[model samples]
Target: MTLRATIVRPDARIVVQFSCGAASAVAGKLALAQYGATHDVQFLNAFLASEDADNRRFLADCEIWTGRQFTVLRDEKYGADVQNVFLRERYLKGPHGAPCSKLLKRRLLDAWKKPGDVMVLGYTAEEADRLEDFRERNPDRPVIAPLIERGLGKEDCKAIILRAGIVLPYMYRAGYSNANCPGCPKGGEAYWRAVRVDFPEVFEARCQVQDELGPGSWFLRYRSGPRKGERFPLRELPYGPIRRNESLPSCSFFCEMAEADIIHKEPTA
Candidate 1:
């Protein structure tokens, strides 16, 4: 009698980091459309307390649109609170980066991400430089940036999400460019001013964080004059019209993998 051998092969896992922004939402959709049959694609989110409360609503909408639920990861130590990360680390922003990015996102990713899992992000055609920077830093990790490959930009991503009948998050509607945590430390003068006006509670919370971190801790910068490159405090930022041109760098954990979401026809505020 002859015996035949049987082999089993598991589908490769494609982990999409969905940050609840339009770009990421579209990217996740694209990844699913392309790989859902051949690969085990999973959407992941590094939830932060600082993001707008409406992010949860947008997240649910995206899940319905995509027909796939996200595996949410968060900094258990800080309960995914950016402020707690800052306070515990005894630091805010610096030349390297912010502690919240490190502790809230990256560390959680390191713990949860598995070997042999291909990662996906929302880097668009305009962000090829960022994609390249991430690859240069994380040569060992396999990644697939669908937005970049498809020549899509942020607007394209937003359009795609809108077509899918999902409402964009409140942050984007409010005129802040990206869906990063409200009062993200990476914001500039205009960004902070927008935060102050649109999200006064969040702005004041960030100011309180700076006060807690104490001297030498700052989240803004002086664009010109002798103070150029000096750390500017959030409280000192003057109220003014927000310049819509500025966009925040993506703030997911893997951003340092380099580094650096959405919905809807939701009407712009």
Candidate 2:
């Protein structure tokens, strides 16, 4: 008598997009490393914003980890278009008005996606809602959530990165939260507060966008909170000049929102 083992090979090509965050980027890097080591895989740098030192660091880390050259796709042009008012009003409205994600992330992904290729998203099981949302939106794309499949939450992913000896992005350390952008519209009041305190220049730029686009424009409606409330008073908060320090606030975006001022006072006419 004889026994035999069968190896099942994946049908679709695997590609992980690096977004430059503690959890997502690390997860993507790990996936790239693992798949590249055992099977054929491709890595992509779908950078939607300007190249910064932090972005370079993530790329370098990916190179070191995967021992392979990663392909870079420039999507900064798409990100810039979202800054335009006409485009925002004409195409995106209400919940979709902020086109940052669509322009910066989604468009790039669409351009790179192949019919049979599997897109590996960094969403974890803890973010079930987001995972479901991604699946719903990209029904034809066949998205794969390896982090969720592995039962690794954000903290676990962070621990993996730390254990791997790769430092997280400076924005994460500065307490601005998500590494998407320094002043992402998805950020909450405390996120803005942290921005105002830690990255004054970026905060000022965001305020300028608000001033130009009018209030309640740049940030996500829920995350922005009420129009009348000030999570951190603009007058009292730090602004203009930038400063840097090694230590970061203990809490990141997830925990910081709770401490923010959430109430909105009625506007006086």
lDDT of 1 by residue, 96-116 (tens): 677788778877788888888
Model 2: CA > 4 A from native: 1-11, 37-39, 48-52, 76-94, 215-269
The whole-model C-alpha lDDT of candidate 2 against the native structure comes to 0.53
Candidate 2 lDDT score at position 69? 77
Q: Which stretches of candidate 1 lie over 4 Å from their true place?
A: 1-10, 226-229, 239-241, 259-269
lDDT of each residue in 82-186, candidate 2, tens digit only: 344223443222332234555555556567767677555666657656556445444444555667767788778777877878877666565444465554544
RMSD, candidate 2, Å: 9.8
Query: How much RMSD separates candidate 1 from the native structure?
Result: 10.0
Model 2 steric clash pairs: none
